[model samples]
Target: MIVLSEESQRTSGKDAQNMNITAGKAVAESVRTTLGPKGMDKMLVDSGGSVVVTNDGVTILKEMDIDHPAANMIVEVSETQEDEVGDGTTSAVVVAGELLDQAEELLDQDIHATTLAQGYRQAAEKAKEILEEDAIEVTEDDRETLVEIAQTAMTGKGAENSKDLLADLVVDAVLAVKDEDGIDTENVSVEKVVGSSIDQSELVEGVIVDKERVDENMPYAVEDANVALFDGAIEVKETEIDAEVNVTDPDQLQQFLDQEEEQLREMVDHLVDIGADVVFVGDGIDDMAQHYLAQEGILAVRRAKSDDLKRLARATGGRVVSNLEDIESDDLGFAGSVAQKDVGGDERIFVEDVEEAKSVTLILRGGTEHVVDEIERAIDDSLGVVRTTLLDGQVLPGGGAPEAELALQLRDFADSVGGREQLAVEAFADALEVIPRTLAENAGLDPIDSLVDLRSRHDGGEFGAGLDAYTGDVIDMEAEGVVEPLRVKTQAIESATEAAVMILRIDDVIAAGDLKGGGSDDDGDEPAGGPGGAGGMGGMGGMGGMGGAM
Candidate 1:
């Protein structure tokens, strides 16, 4: 019979629960202060001295390098929230920590983990229902409302100063890429370039090629461009198997070179015959072919990346042709203009004013690298919220309005399900108030007073009322133009509840011994009957020795 050794470390019941909850709360505390519009930023430095400064929840948690399995689960909650809604990551983590906190209190009162898990799951379902019922419908033509949603997302971020301009650009970019099927964010590209003011950022009606013209002799600009997307290289292809030609006479070698040149010339002749004014080649272009194309007054770009080629095809209404011999007039793309311009000592190609482009480009300009990066993060948040809004066609008031309303409704729901589970449900409701409380605290206001006022106002039929973290005043979020997509709140609640339940369900933890250096003391004294001692067994004998000694 196989016998288990008593020397193995095992933690169960209250000990395991306490340890997991402590680790989760510690992680939550690390990011709690970075919650609201007035939230402070965290500067994380790795062992190698690399630094990252931001208030983004997922970024901060991901950089922390958490070790505890339970804590990592909390981090996953934030990550899942960010992946699903693209915002409210901090709120999700904070709520999850609070749920565990409340669960600990219930555990002290002899409440089973299974009971707590069931209540939390039920509360999550009701919270999602509340969010959907409270959402305000928005139409595609509501440009003003859409702009407000974008501005609200960008507020208190690096892009606040230019939020109006950036919001307008974001709205236009989303609309430009929206089709009958749905909105595809991949079609809207955001390109960041430093050394310019933010106001200089503009939207291009087509794709922006980051490369320069292939030949210097080619025209700088081509109007009424007929673009051809070549997936193959312009150079002559060698045979599949290697073979060398031996020519004893110099005339035979010259003839071989002339034939290669003739092939390149004919390739260029084919392009000119098909009325191709510009070419975007996915592979290298031979020097001879470049010269011939330039001589024919054709614009060409070589070494285009596959992603850029795809975007070009979408913007120009063309297909990527793999074989040059199969090139036809129908395979070509139409563009109003294709030009090359030099900015900051770098050449960039612009394919602009396509006939009916489903893809658009937003060029972001800033004074420095750091500024541009922050702006990109801000714009990313804006774009995500806009896309969510367009897809769901529903939105909720921001600035903690949804949380306050949800809390009030959930309390009444708890009363209906009166039992031990009712206590857990009520705890879930109280946990949600963390959002507004943190917002108030971050804005330098009295959290207790703010919560009281918010609850009272919400109870008095002011469903849209929320704390304006900027001024610490209770105002109607809708009237103040503070709004967010309904999915953000719903996603946060669902993820936080699921994580809390998963952690609460754990009742036992068995940790394996460290196997790297073997079980030896710092004094270098081996126990009696250990592996090298009287017993012939190795590590297993050491375990028996430890049990006997203890």
Candidate 2:
């Protein structure tokens, strides 16, 4: 009966369940208002006074610094959604919260937790099926629809005003990186530059090296350039063991300096002989080597990031030479031009105008740093959704159209099971409506009126009809150019359900006991720090400690 320690604390049975459910619901409510295009933003200020203004569910949850375990689980739902498809994070967290609320109602009706979990699993599987059935066919050739998908992903975010430009850039980036294995969004990089407007953003045909030429005396620009990439440094070797030069005479010092100058000259002559006009090195450039390369009229950029070098190789069709001795003619990649330009008051070398580039970069320009940072987040989300759409080859109308359709279909499917489990399945169907309802509420429309109109449209067999957050009219989402990837909806349902079921099954929470010190005396009497000293049996009410209504 005294299995736990004295300082331990515990909540059990109905109290534990209610406590967990409330914590999950609280997390859901925190981000509820950040649900749609019209949804408000969350301004998070951390303990250090650093601020983040984003409606992005994962970002908000990450910055919230939540303490409760169950609330953290709900945050994981958003994180999972973002990792899987990069969109629908808000919808996933909201759906999970609503699922917890619905399960709480069933707990009041004496339904066992296992039964609710089983029914939820069944409902989640059917929901994915409904989403697949509702999916509209889309291909890479459907540029218009793909752009719409990107636009929908950035609709209410900071990039909405420039969504058209951003979406087009995103779709183009995805398409450029598409291969037989599908599109890898990692091949595209977004570089933000302040002091420019949004519309001035351009898609660079090659990677943008955030470094400048190693020496200012070298050429600032080169056209029709032959590029060389190195994975090692272009500096003189230092002795591994400690060695001292006995420079008792001036001739010995001159001999040492001449030897170093000769070594640097050889390296520069080697590059000039290779006809390499632009060079990127993975390590530092020695000052003497810099003088030599500058004299040779070669542009050498040192301390380049390894990832940028890889990307540069891919774009320029060049191989990264490991050493100067291993250099060959084929190791040099070709670029139309290599130039150093001042962007946002910082000098950056551009390896661009590549032919048939497999890796690309986006130069995102904004009037300010914060504006560009938020724009970068929006562009990243847009790129992910577009890539998901192309990979799945299917999309669904956005603006809660998919949720409304799935809710109706799930209800009819729930009726086919006719048992206590059926009630849970129906509850799931109702929870799915939270998407459209939240969308309505965020847009300041009457939730009841919007829900009614939406259900009537679905009931009348119009599967595409959904609430227009802009006009409060129930119109066809497909016609309104609102769309998202099929993966977004299915992934959200799966993640939300798993999180809800997991939280619902926890009926006990035992916090760790305090580690108390002090030992008993030599007698066989009660210990010095005995049960009465802290929380032995007192913590559990002597085995009858299901406090409150158990």
Candidate 3:
């Protein structure tokens, strides 16, 4: 209509649905290959020439600069999964995409979008119940089970070759931070050092400050050191308002300078009086203060991060004093040894052997930057899963066992539902099989063959049946030490179903302006915007290989 703006464009009915579904599915396919232990990685490079080589689903999706509305929704699924469990981001997105695929098929059969959405919602609720029923109960006190959970999460990741070592460290770190309130993963900090291999990573009894002593004249190490943490600077404070000092004589100017020095000296004196041999300053330390600190034989680190200060307080059983005047003897934390060591040609401060430290750090060593980075990501995911397992108090068999089990149960559920919605439910059941199928496909196994094998096993009441990607065999995932936090699967199913249902119910798409159509330069084909190279979603022009991920 002439009344409409020139830039506004709209597509209704089937065309709109297909265009949306196609974009969403394409986004899913982009990250599909990077799933499972056998999955490949995607190297994402930005316009700034920064490169990220990771198989992690959320990382890949986040790096990609997608603009398509439908495609962006798929990315949200990954984000939500990551936020909830810090694991299974890929699985969540993949499941959502597959759900859309299934919905498309049902739509082709003349099943209304409302019917599909309703069935998907029902199936999602039932899936969570099935997951809960099949889950194995776990507790925070179960160390062995927790270790296995950590190892399973790290499986097939970059650190898998040395997962045994890292898993032990992760489990220990998580357990160390676990209190009556539950595990606070933030209490566990990871410090990366390039030189040693991944297996060389160790759980530090205390914090590692990636900083050196403020002065070289100070002692490199202290035995049974008492630590002091300050949120304020050790420098002389200036007047809040601008004021001109009337110094009529040179002696008066010298007196003003001496007063500033006295202030800095007093701050250092307070630490010495409190028997503090080490100081971590959140803000800058004045040059004079450094001299005083070194003169007092105290190992002081300036510009320490606030987080490090908090962890230091936890490790040392000390307080982070905001003011020098307020500091007391009890404000000091303890470390068996605080030393500055040269690591990989760089100096770092280590606060080690804190007695019964609630805060612990993991020094992750690797051969190179990329290696260390991948290790950090792997351990991060592992820690998250282990912590989540402790929090949820339940877990499910991994390696697609939960999906396989859920699919079998849903079929039985679909049989009980009446009306045309039953077909939607059945289709949802088939969609759940995509996980196991993709797992087999990524491992170079026959998808159909694996599906049949899984279905046959589940038909015989083997609820724990799953694909062992390494061997291309169907086996008991739990017995094989392949388990995942129950929240991971539950959240993935629920989030995916909601996303899929939302995308499915959209029967119309309207842009702010008369949107141009997306086209291919090679053959000038519009595969997505509208039917057969027509006008529609032009803003999605770069989405085909968007973010350089696809």
TM-score of each: 0.90, 0.91, 0.94
Candidate lDDT (C-alpha), each: 0.83, 0.83, 0.84
Q: How accurate is candidate 2 locally (lDDT)?
A: 0.83
Q: Write the per-residue lDDT of candidate 3 for residues 1-550, one digit (tens) a residue.
A: 4865777778788877877787777777778888899988777666667777788888877777667787788889999988778889889999998998888888989999999988888888899998888799998788888888888877767888998889899988988888888888899998888897887788988888889888989999999998889988999988899988898999999999999999999888888998988889998989999999999999889889999999999889999988878989988888999999877788889889888879999988999887788788888889889989989899988888888888888889999888888888888988988899999999999999999999999889988889999898899988888889999998999888888888888888888964334323346444543322212223333433443325
Off by over 4 Å in 3: 1-3, 513-526, 529-549
What CA RMSD would candidate 1 show? Answer: 8.4
lDDT of the structure predicted as candidate 3 = 0.84
Across 69-131, the per-residue lDDT of candidate 2 in tens digits comes to 676788899999888899899999999989998998999999999899999999999989888
For model 1, what is the alpha-carbon lDDT of residue 446?
97
RMSD of each: 8.4, 8.2, 2.8
Q: How many residue pairs clash per model?
A: 0, 1, 4
